[model samples]
Target: MSDAEGSNEITTIENPYAYLERDFSSENFKIEVKNLPKFYGMNEFRKLLNEKLKLHSNKIKTTRKNSPYAFVCFRNEEDRENAINVLTNYKWKGYDLQILKAKPAPDPLVKKRKENAEDLHSNKKTKTEEVCSQEEKLKNSTIPYHNVEYDQQLKLKLEDIKKVLKKFGSELSRQNTELKNWIEKQKFLYDGLPCELLDIRFSDTTEGYRNKCEFTVGIDEDTNLPTVGFRIGSYVKGTTAVGPVDNLVHIPESMKVAVKIFQDYVRSSDLKVFDPEHHTGHFRQLMARSAQNQLMLVVGIHPQDLTDDQLSEFKTSIVEYFSVGKGTPAKVTSLYFQKIVKKNHRDDIVPTEHLWGDTHIYETIMGLKFKISPEAFFQINTKGAELLYKAAIELAEPSENATVLDVCCGTGTIGLCFANKCSQVLGIEVIPQAIVDAKENATLNSIENSDFFVGKAEDILGNICFKATGEDVIAVVDPPRAGLQKRAIFQIRKIPKINKVVYVSCNPMAALQNFVDFGRPESKKVHGVPLVPTKAVAVDMFPYTKHCELVICFERWDKISSKQLQSEELVS
Candidate 1:
C-alpha cells in the first residue's frame, strides 16, 4: 500500500510503491523537490524520503543554507518515475512539495566565454549599423545642427525630473497658474506638470564626479584574473562574480589607478580572493574615498586563522605598494584594514584598525573644514554637496538671532555652516563615531556655537530642553535614504517655538511620506499643530543617475498667524 493509503495505526507498510507507477521517463532520472524545510539536514531528509517512497538514491544534493530545495538522483528511470508519481504532490513539514526533473547546471566558465563572444559580435554590428545610419541621416536631413540633439536631450531629462516630482505629489507654484492651465489642456503634457511644481538645478560637472567607490574583490570572468570592481550579481541571485572596471566614467582617474594597483597587489600575493558563496578566502572588498588630491583606502578581509606575523607581512606589503611615494600614481593619505567575518557585518560593531598615516581625511565644503572618518557618512560628490547645502541654507534663511537645529547631521557639516549666521546650532546623529567626528570638525574650524549629540533623533529630541532665551528656532534636517521616523516627526511638531523647517532629503519618495505625517490634519498631530510646505528645490547631487537631492521649506501655521498679529500690533 502507498504511504498515504495506509492506516494511521499501521506504522510500517508492506509495500511502499504498491500504488506508484513503475513507467518512468528514461530522460528524467533526477527528481527536484522544492519547499523543503530549512531546518532539515540532508541526511534526515534523505532518510525520510527513502522511508516514504521505499526507494534509495545514492546522490542527494542540497543547495545553500536556507535554500528551500534539494535534488535527488535515482539509479534507474523506473525508481525516479515511481518516486515522482507517488510523491509529486506530497506534503512535507506543512509545505506542499513541488517536484520536477532537474536540468544540468551550466558551467560558469563556458557561459561567461559564450557571453563575451556574443557581446563582441553585437558591439561590432551595432557600431557598423550606427555609422551607416548616422551618415545616411546627415545626408538626408536639411538641418543637421548639433544643438537640436542637445535640446532634445534636455527635454528628455526635464521630463524625467517632472515624472519623479509627480510621483512625490509635488505641486507647481500658484504664480505659474497660466502655464499649469495650458499644461492641463494639452493631452501630451497633461501629466508632465501639476498645479504645483519644484525648481531643478543642473549639475556643473556631469561625469567623473563620484568621490567614493566600494569595489568587490573576486576573479574576473573575462580575463580570469583577480580583480577589484563591482559584482555582476548579488549573493542572493547566486552570481557573485565580479568584473574588472578599467574605465568607469563615474570615478576619477586617481581612483581607477588606485583600484588597478590594489588588484595587481592582490593578484601577486599569496592571499586568496574572496568568494561570497563559500564565504572563505582572505581579501573581500576595497573602499576608496577621494577628496581633492588625496585618497583613503580601506581594505576589508576575512582573516581566517592567520598568524600575527602573517598579518603584519600583509599590511606591510599593502603599505609599501600603495603608500604615497615619488612614483606612486595616487596619493593615499590614509590606509585602514578592517576584518569582516559575515556578509552583513556592521562597521561600528567590527572595529577598523588604522594601519598607516592619518586616521581622518579633511574635506572643505562651503568654506568650512570637515573631518571625514572611515565609517562616517559624507556626501560622495563634494562639489555637488556645496550646491545642495547652499540651497538648504538659502531656504532656511536663519536670522542672526535664530538657533538652528540640524538633524541627522553627519559630521555636523550643515550645522557648522549655519554657525556663522545663527546664534546657536544643535546637531544630532545616531552614529557615535559620526558624532565624534562632528565634534572634532567643529573644533578644527574653531566654531564653538555648534553642539552635537549622539542618539536616535526620535528618542532623544523629545526629552531635550531648549534654552529659555526665546530665540527664533529653525531646523535643518538632512535625513538618510530611509527618511525620518514618525515619532521624530511628532517630536519636531511638539516644539512649539520652531517656526521654519528646512528638510534636506536624499530620497524624495520617502521624504514625501514624512511630509504627509507632519502636514496632514487628518493624520496624527502633535500639540494640535501642522506644518505647511511652502517652497521646494531639487539639486542634482548624483549626476547621470535617477537620484537628486531635494530641499523643502515648511512653516508652522500658528507661527505665521502669530507673526501677522505682531505686524498688526507694530502698525498700531
Candidate 2:
C-alpha cells in the first residue's frame, strides 16, 4: 500500500480495546509529550508519529511558540497505549521524549470556591484553638523549662538531622554508586575518617541565641487589644489571631520587654493592626534584629493615605516609646519605617525608609566584623555560623598560593574567613547591596586580596575567562536553599583551573540534586567534565530546628592540559 493510503487506513482503523465511559472524554484520552524538538510543529509531530510508530492521532495540540512539547489525543485508549508503548522512551532530535497521560484540568472558579470554603473552615477552627490556648496560658502566667522535656526535644532534633543526612547520603550513593565505592576503596581524605553521628556545638547563650524575630502586628485574641507577636498559624492556614511571644523561650529577655512595651504603645495609640485577610489597617509587622547588646527595629506599616505629618507623628511616638520612655529595657540602635504592601509579603525589592539611629549593625564572626543592613542576609545563629564557616574553610583547604572563588557569597563571610590563607579571594552575589556589604566587610577586616562582583553565580561563572593564579584553584559555594542551578554547575565544570569545590548547602535534599548534576557521568556530556565527591560533613547550624548545613568537597577528575598547567606555573 502507498504511504498515504496506509496513513488513511490507520486513521480509520477500529479501536477494539475496552475503555471506561469516562475515557470518551477528550481529557481522559489525551497524552502530553514533553522534550520534543523545539522546531517540531503540530503537523510535523503528527506526521512523525504516523510515519515512525504507525499510530494515528485524532487531534494534535501544540503549545505556544518555541515550546518543546505538544499534546496528542487518540480516538480510543488502544491507540494511546500503542503510542506510549512505541514512543515513551524513544529518542527524537537528540532528546528523550517524555510521554504521560494528561491530567484533567480543574475549573478555576470551582477550585477557587472550594479553596475559599476550606480556608474559612480552617480559620474558624484555628481561631477557636488559639483562644483556648491563650486563655490557658494567661491564667497560668508561668514559663518553666523541664530538663527532661528539653533533652527529649534536642534528641528529636538530632534524630531528624540524622534521618535527613542519611537520606541525602543514600540518594548520592544511588545516583553515583561507582563513585561511592571508589571513594571507599581508595584512601580518600575522608575515607576511614571518624564520622561523628552528631557534633553538638552548644550555643554560648542558648536562651537568646536567635538574633532576629519578625512579629506580626495584630489584636490579641483574649484581650481584643492591639499587640505584637506571631499569628496562631499561617495566614493562609486560617489563622487571624496573634499569639504573644513574651514568654517564648527562644527570644531574648530584652526582646520580650521591647515587644510588651510596643504592644502597650500601640494599644494606647489610634493605629490599627493590619488584617492580612481583609488587606486593611496600618501597622503590619515588627522586625527586630539584635546584635551585641544593640537592637535594630523595622516597623512595617501600610502607610495607607497618611500624610507626611501623620507618618512623622507615628514615627515620633515609636521613637519616644523605645528610646525616651521612663524605663526603657532595650537600646534602639537603628530604627526603620518600611512601607509594606499587604499582598506582597515576599517582596524585598521595596525600600525601607530610615527613621532613626545608625544605618547598619555590626556582628563579629570568627573575629571578623561584618556590617549588616536590615535587608542583608546573615546567619541568625552568630556562634553557630562560626562553626559552619570554620567547617567550610577547613574542607576548602585553601593553600597559601591558591585563589578561592566564593559563589553566592552573601556578605562575603566565608570568603573573608579564608582571605588570609589564600592568595586572593573572588566572591559573587546577586544582590548589589550584599556585594557592597561584602566589600565593606573585606575592608573592615583589612583583607586587601579580596574582590566581590554583583551578579548571579551562573552568569558570572559561565563567562569567567581568567586563568588560575596558582597550582590549584578552589571554589566555595554557599548557594541558597533552592541549591545551585544547572547553568551554575556547567560553568563550574568549564573552569579547568578550579580542581576543588567546597559546597556549603543549607538544604541537603535540594543539594543532592546539585550533587547529581555535578558528579554524575551523564552531566559530563553537557559540561565536558565531572567532579568527584571527596568528603562531606554536616554542621549543626540550627540546633533546635530540623535544619543543618552540609559541606561537601568535590574535586575535578580532569586537570588542565600539560601546556595550560605549564603556562599557569610560569605566570604564578
Clashing residue pairs, backbone N/CA/C < 3 A, model 1: 171-196, 171-197, 172-196, 172-197
Model 1: ten consecutive residues of lowest lDDT: 11-20
Candidate 1, superposed: residue stretches over 4 Å from native: 1-161, 164-198, 324-327, 347-349, 463-465, 522-526, 559-572
Q: What is the Cα-based TM-score of model 1?
A: 0.68
Candidate 2 lDDT over 364-464, as tens digits, reads: 99899999889888987888789888887877788899988888888999889988888988888999989999999998999988888889787887444
- TM, every model: 0.68, 0.71
Best by TM-score: 2
Q: Rate the local accuracy (lDDT) of all candidates.
A: 0.70, 0.71
Leading candidate by lDDT:
2
The local lDDT score (0 to 100) that residue 481 gets in candidate 2 is 87
